[model samples]
Target: MTEHLDPDAMLVAYDAQLRAHVPPVLPAGVTAEHDGPLLRMVGFDHGGFVVPYRDLSGLDSAELDALIARQRDFFAARGERFEWKLYGHDLPADLPDRLIAAGFEPEELETVVIGPAAPLARPPVLPEGVTLREVSSRADLDRIAAMEEAVWGEDRQWLAEGLEKEIAADPDSVTVVVAEADGTVVSAGWVRYVPGTEFAGLWGGSTLAQWRGRGIYKALVAYRAIRAVERGYTYLQVDASPDSRPILNRLGLASITTTTPYVWSPAE
Candidate 1:
């Protein structure tokens, strides 16, 4: 006989499995801090918490409220931007309203897709003059960061620092691939393979306007997929934007769910 799992229980199991498999690359100064049963980070940029509500098995309302108050104090002390990455299924009894009352603002939602890595190994062909290469050196990382900032309209310091830490912690699990033509990085992406999990995540797939629809992104995906398979990961996951959704669909990945990021800023 099969056992039935409650929806909330199943979500908690999934969240724990994913988090255990892939430890988030917490920013510098952010240390793993716990409040009661809540596992979170504190003392980092404006301070935030992971707040695994799905796994809040032993917590009472008072404990939960204290956790929120702690987070609020942490943010107020530093006067920096704060973020809480909450999932749709993680809606506890009154999370949204409480967060809003505490000054958190919601951001756009993105699809979370997971599937076997085989399809990614067979990415579509790239247009002429476009070629894919894995970046292993600091100089290559700098180039990739520059291209990313150019395409996404942001500074590269955050990404550069994050990548540097990842490389220092476990170089083999992270791969940065860039698509270049005519001596410029027109397209780029990266993947992080969790050491013990079946999941490998693709991130930072940025391409220049002129380079879209030429299969460069797909090729980059393929490159990362190949890397994931090489590292013994069976599944590839991506928090995809609408622009990449159709291509990922073509590659046989299904949308498992959505992730929405809520931000709290000092200015607000």
Candidate 2:
């Protein structure tokens, strides 16, 4: 982390590590299966997830088209929604178009940013009257869902369900924290110390509208970074939204790729 980092080289390592299935096992309620080069996780509370390993270069046009359709049917049979995690650098260049043609809808684009965790583990910097606390109770989890709902104007009941299952399976691998002021949760986030990898994935940082630009989000990042560092992780990673991408970049995480989700919902 001290010497100048070669972003390209580090990114290559990150891709390789991910392709190897760094976690190696899904949570208890979920399962993984392979469709040729693509690995899919099924039974998440939200639905299935396609791992974005970026290994589609070898498939021909027809073969790729069939692969996309197959995933759609696979999920439809179970009446579940699914997502194909597509990155800007994923090969076949037309993969995004192919997904769209298969009835998949593209969602928000995010940057895949990563950085050395050591430097980011400084004491959290929160605004006056704000305090961050690590959370575990069901009440705390419900509060996080409420915070997310207020930020995005939708029911986020799925967050509590998924986080509960994950925490029950391995308390050591995940950490959830919330920023509180005036006895209410204002911002929340979590970090997963993915097993068998050098990286810890950071999720959330959903702050209430009234709390924007107050450094609570950044403090959440720093707090998660500290947990990652203490847990022996070398790098911190996030699929950064536009609002957070600039802040993370300034904090030293390199934006190596752009990830956009292409989703398919089962017909009612």
Candidate 3:
């Protein structure tokens, strides 16, 4: 049954429909620019994100070297921590190696899971004393960020800041949902609806170790899926980490491809 959903085709659709079609609707102060073939979103000061697309099959080693240099120089000049997103199926199979040679550090490789949101929208039965809530107030947002920090073992101030701006700009486009148990946020996640596209993004799903098997994560997915459907999005896409991949697979999302973010930070 799943074979009918061609992973290659889905990947093609992702690059074309999502990456090429709908650019990110960034926060108020950010600026998105088209520098020839690259789609660059800047203004985060600390860094930015870049999307590069092309058929590398025709380029020689020299040309490939030059292209990589150009990308490096472009971001380096800005003194930012830029991430160039690359997919598993992208051409010139050695592209990963080239990125490493250009001072770009590869982050974790994530499986790109995507599927219709309907199957995931059914609310799961939560454990007793657990409740789900769509975060609205600053207090709720802080709670969610705190939960994420505990889960990831890092200061997640960026998560809180980004969510605050997103909510302030367009609350409907960003849904940050959390599962509260006994007045404490146990698990949290968010969904981003990109207007002008059929896809929504699922991000920041993290659960405390004690709440692992209870179904809080699934509830978070369900709530976000419901919100995505309400916003007229057909598909939900997530860059699934090893821990969440199996769970999301059970929810019917296909792991169509792998993606790795090669990050470049300007020299000090």
Candidate 4:
């Protein structure tokens, strides 16, 4: 499927639809600011996130430096950390270096992979002792956070809070699912249907290390794809990690570009 896909065309649509999109509504405590040449999503329990799709190629170094500093100061003055998302195809080739020089630390680079959803909407094939189920509740969200903590060996309490906000903002736009073994959470993932677009984003497919390589991750993806198709969404998207990129590639999605988060903190 990927062989027939035009990466350039996919990126064109992605930029036009997802990148250019500004949220029409946000839940309480969250707000969007359309600063000059930038759109910043702020007040998340996790922190702020700058939309990755802006064009900065026209700005010279000093102009760009001022722009970057403005964002850093905006968040810092609020005593918060925020992220500026940079895509690999973004012009002004030295942008990353400039961001680093300005004290923004770069996070891991992730591939932005996408493909039509219809092809991935197959019936999931789960291994023995595991079952897939859609969930909605603070309890379920807490369970997912615990599983995520075990998967990454870190505190994930914020995940529960963030998911709650997302679900509250628009329950129809998001679907959360978990894979369980003997009633214990083993793997999980979610789908968020991008409003007014053909895309549905698959996020947070984390499985416990003990359960890795057991078809659980792929099954969760299949479940999300099925949900996407049923919701009238035509395509699927993922910010694929190195571990997930190969699986998504085999599942028919191909990377169109890469995105790295350049983070700045008010606190050292």
Candidate 5:
């Protein structure tokens, strides 16, 4: 068995190698601008997003407040839902409180779990009636989108649009997977390999409520881990939700830190 890593040191290394060294994930023709330490991404597949690419370990109160307001205005003028990705180690000692005061609602607090992808590639022992595979057909696309929507209780338009772009490009950087039972998609997930980095992100690991207790979710993670190793990615990372954190931890991924998204939705 592989030894579990020290979470703090691993998170520091991840911030440097993956978060700072790589550009924000965006489709072709979409662009982002850097303002101080903030990266303002526009026209990304899933609306607008703001990332603090580096540590904000030195900002004063006034400056921090201005930065938050600037980000809000940048997205508000574009009429986009803005997501500010926040790490647990973010500076000023009260960043989360500031974000909430700025009308940014706190989303789910997720554990930043990461580990070697190869170890997670063990053959998935799925339940008797279920099968897992890479999704390819348009019919499967719709099914996957529907499954995600049902699981999250949200619309799947952005998810579908993002998946379609990835499918059309076939860039080998992203792959979508789904679990099916009796011809219905019961769970769906995807893995995105970031260029110039050692990490691949596992996202959208959602299963229908009724399919919760089965091993379907674990099977999906294993399938994606194998795919990540195939693409030469050393680490598989995920912002694991509360429901999935224990499962990932059991699979040997370390819960390095907590990450939360502060969302500021511009008036529609």
Candidate 6:
């Protein structure tokens, strides 16, 4: 039976799950600093400075505005360009559209899906000559990153670096796996098992164009779920793109809600 869920309630549940499980994978040199009611990070990337913000609810409107302004000043003083990522459902009703007024532009909406970890434990069948392997070395990591880059058309250097850091920081908490055929990776993904949270997040599920519809992606997801359950995670969550949503749906993951980001970039 399809269980009907209230969108608002689902959003709250999804947010809590995300906050608990998938804490921001901030880039290197990006420190997470809390300023009373504001949780922000500053990443000193060669591209410029990236500032990502999360709402800290203890503050009233006036205090929140003051904190935002202070962050802007701090970054400006460092001669860095700033970018703010505002989640769609996070804007307070009483708060003015100051971010937009500050020139933030809305980006595409993404869906947050969550479901039990059990469904992913089931074994998946891949096409002939394909096999799944868990990555354990720097060489494997590079290969996985390269496959992801080729599949998604994005430079995955950042992702590889982040994963390497996580594995080094907490070896038991991170897992990267790839599906390969005749020594070439065709699909890949990773899962992060966050302590103190009931969720495990699946990330970077990219498959080669020629590999679509062959159950490689689903098998990768199942592999992660199995690992998540083994580590006692009750929920599996993903910020799914449209290409992956249908597969997740077929796997019984419910779409909790949509998450859109409003971006404030220096160029805008």
The top-ranked prediction according to TM-score is: 4
Q: List lDDT for all candidates, in order.
A: 0.71, 0.88, 0.81, 0.89, 0.82, 0.69
* Winner on lDDT (1 vs 3): 3
The CA root-mean-square deviation of candidate 2, after full C-alpha superposition on the true structure, stands at 1.6
RMSD of 5: 2.0
Order of models, best TM-score first: 4, 2, 5, 3, 1, 6
TM-score of each: 0.83, 0.96, 0.91, 0.97, 0.92, 0.80
* Alpha-carbon lDDT of model 5: 0.82
Model 2 residue runs over 4 Å out of place are: 1-3, 19-25
Residue 142 in model 4: lDDT: 98
Alpha-carbon RMSD, each predicted model? 4.4, 1.6, 2.1, 1.1, 2.0, 3.9
Summarize candidate 2's per-residue lDDT along 62-93 as a digit string, tens digits. 99998888999999999999999998888989
lDDT of 1 by residue, 148-209 (tens): 78877878756666676667656776898889899898988889877556678899898988
Score candidate 6 by lDDT: 0.69
Model 3 error, position 72 (Å): 2.7
Backbone clash pairs for candidate 6 read none
What's the number of clashes in each of the models?
A: 0, 0, 0, 0, 0, 0
Candidate 3 weakest ten by summed lDDT: 20-29
Q: What is the TM-score of candidate 2?
A: 0.96
Model 1 TM-score (2 dp): 0.83
Best by lDDT: 4
Write model 5 residue lDDT over 102-218, tens digit each, in one string.
Answer: 989998899888888988988888998999888766777888888888887888867777677666655576888888899998998899888888899999988999998889889
Q: For residues 116-137, write the lDDT of model 6, one tens digit per residue.
A: 7875698877789999899868
Per-residue alpha-carbon lDDT of model 4 for 1-268, expressed as tens digits?
Answer: 9987899999988988998476566766888878777888988988898864456889887888998888888888898988988998987888899889988999999999998898889999999989999998999999999999998899999889988987888788789999999989998899988889999999999998999998999999999999999989999999999999999999999899999999998766
RMSD of 3: 2.1
Give the clashing pairs for model 3. none
